[model samples]
Target: MSLLVCAYVFVPETNTTVAINEQPKAPFNNLFGFESWRQTVWDSPILRKHNCTLLNSLSSQDIYAGDAVLLQLQNELEVIKEHIDQITDELNLHKESFAFRIDNAFEAIRIAQKVTNGIVYIG
Candidate 1:
């Protein structure tokens, strides 16, 4: 089985007077398949060092408010991309494929960062 890392921007309904029982709306522009790279991301030293909640959580549902988390994840991905070539073959990682996945995931996060008063959902 392959794991796909997808990010979506969810804008909550703004009903100040009374609570509305309606599903949140999100755009499908930000999405990418991570394939088998879930473990790689979960074990990333750069992400671990920064204590990325979204990336580190084992839960299927994770949410982050604002672009700060998005920017931090993007930076960590950049650091991993820089040193991806240094990873040993013993880990069975494809440098090119993994790099492509990182790029796609980066773009997804970048797109999600543009939404104001919206929460980012990762799963």
Candidate 2:
């Protein structure tokens, strides 16, 4: 079976007000433009730093789904999209497996641009 990693965007809470049984309404995995992979690169500190930078750039002081953070996120995603494009172009000789992942990553970032919540990744 193939491994699938999903990404989610949600509100960051200071306390555990939510019940354990409740499921968060975070954005769909595809919303963040994340791609499926076998490893755990998404949880890395470097990536988290990038995510933090994006969030810090948002207008709203709190993380939520409608505070006008979308624009900022979109702008941040552009940088990642450019890098992915470059890698995809370089791998033109083998556009079968990794290429598809690159495509998925692009799609995820595109969707993430419209999101308003802070990013919460689940793999």
Candidate 3:
């Protein structure tokens, strides 16, 4: 039952907002959790392909049907996969850039603090 629930939500897109449950609280409740989740998704080509096919087929809309519809769904799925991959790459690049900038900024602050230590007190 737990495995079934996990499998169902392992690639949940925000198409609908059915209340999952009401848990009191948890340690991971922020961007870090989302980042890890995203990494899990972006790390696996097989998983991505699985999600792509599942998402395209699972919807009950006009996209689900005969050969022509299936082809169009496949095409649209390919486009969505490309976009997801591109976004993941861009997010990784930005994360790296932000870390670099923050590191540099901290280094600058440290140097400045050293230079002003005789005349200034931080605390």
Highest lDDT, which number?
Answer: 1
lDDT of 3 at 54: 34
Instruction: Give the TM-scores of the predictions, in the order they appear.
Output: 0.57, 0.34, 0.22
**Off by more than 4 A, model 3:** 1-63, 86-123
Task: Give the Å error, residue 4, model 2.
Answer: 2.6
Kindly list the per-residue Cα lDDT of model 1 for residues 1-123, writing each as its tens digit: 444444444545642222122222343223333534445655455456555555655234443534676676676667666666654243456776666656666655655555454333444
lDDT of 1 at 35: 34
Tens-digit per-residue lDDT, 2-93, candidate 3? 00011011113653323223221232111111233333432345434545543322222211122343344345445544464454464544
Q: lDDT tens string, model 2, 21-102?
A: 2232333222322233222233334334456354332222323322354444445445445554443454332334444543
Score residue 70 of candidate 1 by CA lDDT: 65
The true-versus-predicted C-alpha distance at residue 87 of model 2, in Å, is 7.2
Q: Which 10 residues in a row give candidate 3 its minimum summed lDDT?
A: 1-10
Error of 3 at 121 (Å): 67
Candidate 1: count of backbone clashes, pairs at least 3 residues apart or interchain: 0
Off by over 4 Å in 1: 13-37, 44-54, 58-65, 88-90, 118-120
| Candidate 2: residue pairs that collide | 32-108, 33-108, 33-109
